[model samples]
Target: MKEAILAAIKAYDTIILHRHVRPDPDAYGSQMGLATIIQASFPEKQVFSVGNDEASLRFLGKVDEIADELYQDALVIVCDTANTARISDRRYTAGKMLIKIDHHPNDEPYGDLVWVDTSASSCSEMIVSFYETFQEELTLHEEAARLLYAGIVGDTGRFMYPSTTSETFRLTAKLVHFPFDRPALYRHLYEQSLPMTRLAGYILEHFQMEEGGAATVFLPEELLTRFEVDPREASGLVNVIDSAVGLKAWIMFIQEGDVIRARLRSKGPVINELAKEYGGGGHPLASGATIHTLEEMAEMKRKLIAICLETV
Candidate 1:
């Protein structure tokens, strides 16, 4: 797979990178990290990262905008994304050749060269493993290392998640050897504004914790303006319920336009399979889905609670 991906990289002079919509740190990190490493390793290649901006995350890396004509002969690499519906820029199909490098379960194969590693902790981890195969040809620098490390940390929950394998630690050990400031990277990743802190308090106060060890959170669209935050930031609100002593599973449902987007997390149970019941799926411990109404979110919550109870 590495040979095939590297061959595609060498075959095409222009390359465009993309990830899922409403970008998370892992998405941005994997997309930007790959582009950075590729550009540095193959200096002659034109590599670009494309997506919309989350103002709160621009401190990490700037989003790139390119002309549509460039895709005519370009190689597109979609990272950290599961399916086409979730891709930020639909124009990826315009590329001359396509590759899918993802850590998500292989539900659909959309690329000419597809490499999906479900065992990897994150897509960034997979990229590190990819470059390690041809270490002599590729150069790993501080900028790329910092971005990749951030992605691994974000997706692994700072080495606490079950997916954080020994290989994850080994790759991360070498990643931190680079010149970037690890402390500064962490500050940027975890620090929140005062309003965001207060909103987290609100989320905890309104949580619907069931005796069955499941918890549910509901935040209406109107709360976004009240909190003066981008709707994208609401996903972090789910973290408030993560550390509760007896909580086995939790879900955050934020009303976004016509759909209620759910962010689900579990301490022991396999919840991604439940996420699959709706139109979404992800890692076993962390997942997401979307439903049409708050009532549907309630129904999903009840079903999820039942599943959590069984796990207990």
Candidate 2:
């Protein structure tokens, strides 16, 4: 798959990169890191990273303005997105050739060439490994290494999550050979504003646990307005319940306008299947879903509780 993707890259004069919507560190990291490597390798080719406007992690790379016509003869490389709907820019299909590079489990493989490595800790890690595959011919500098390392660290939860592996550490070790401020990266990724901190406090006080160790944090429309912070930003507060002993699973619902976006996590159960039931799918341990109405939210909450209890 890497060779096929490389062939496509060599064939195209213009290459475009993309990631999922509501970009996370891993999303931006893989997108930017690959773009940097490609630009470094083929300085003659024109490469652009396109997606929904860059948000929180734009510091990794500035989102570029791209004309739709440019994609007519381009090779679109989508990183970290599981499916087409999750893609930030739908223009990917318009490209002359499409490539999918991701670590998430593939459901509906959309690309002309697909490379999905579920064992890879993160897409950035996969990108690093991809570079290592062609090391004799390609060069990885600080710009690519730092962003890829940040993606690896972010997705692995600083090596605390179950996804962290020996290869994850080894890949990261290779990146450190390049010069970048690791401490500053942490500050940028983990540090939060005062309002967001207060929002975390609110979640702590408000989240409730049900029978059989299922926990939930629901941010209704009003509370979201009260907080004056994007509900997506508050999504990280779901970590507050990670220390809960005996908890099988947890879900936090953040109201995003018409739909309630769920960030679901599990210590034991396979919840990505459940996420698929609720209109989303991601990794088995960490996944997300979108609920249409209050009724669906209640329905999903009950179903998650059942999963926790092993009653369903």
Q: What is the lDDT of candidate 1?
A: 0.89
Candidate 2: lDDT of 69?
94
Each model's lDDT comes to 0.89, 0.89
The C-alpha local distance difference test score for the whole of candidate 2 amounts to: 0.89
Measured by TM-score, how close is model 2 to the native structure? 0.96
Among the numbered candidates, top TM-score falls to 1
Q: Per-residue lDDT for 1-312 in model 2, tens only?
A: 888887888899999999999898899999999999999998999999989875678678888889999999999999998888889988989999889999998887888999999999999999999999988767788999989998998899999888889999998999998779989989998988887888888888888889888899899878877888887777877787788777789999999889899999988888999998977888888899888898888888899898988833
Model 1: lDDT of residue 196: 87
lDDT of 1 by residue, 44-66 (tens): 98999998877767877998888
Clashing pairs in 1: none
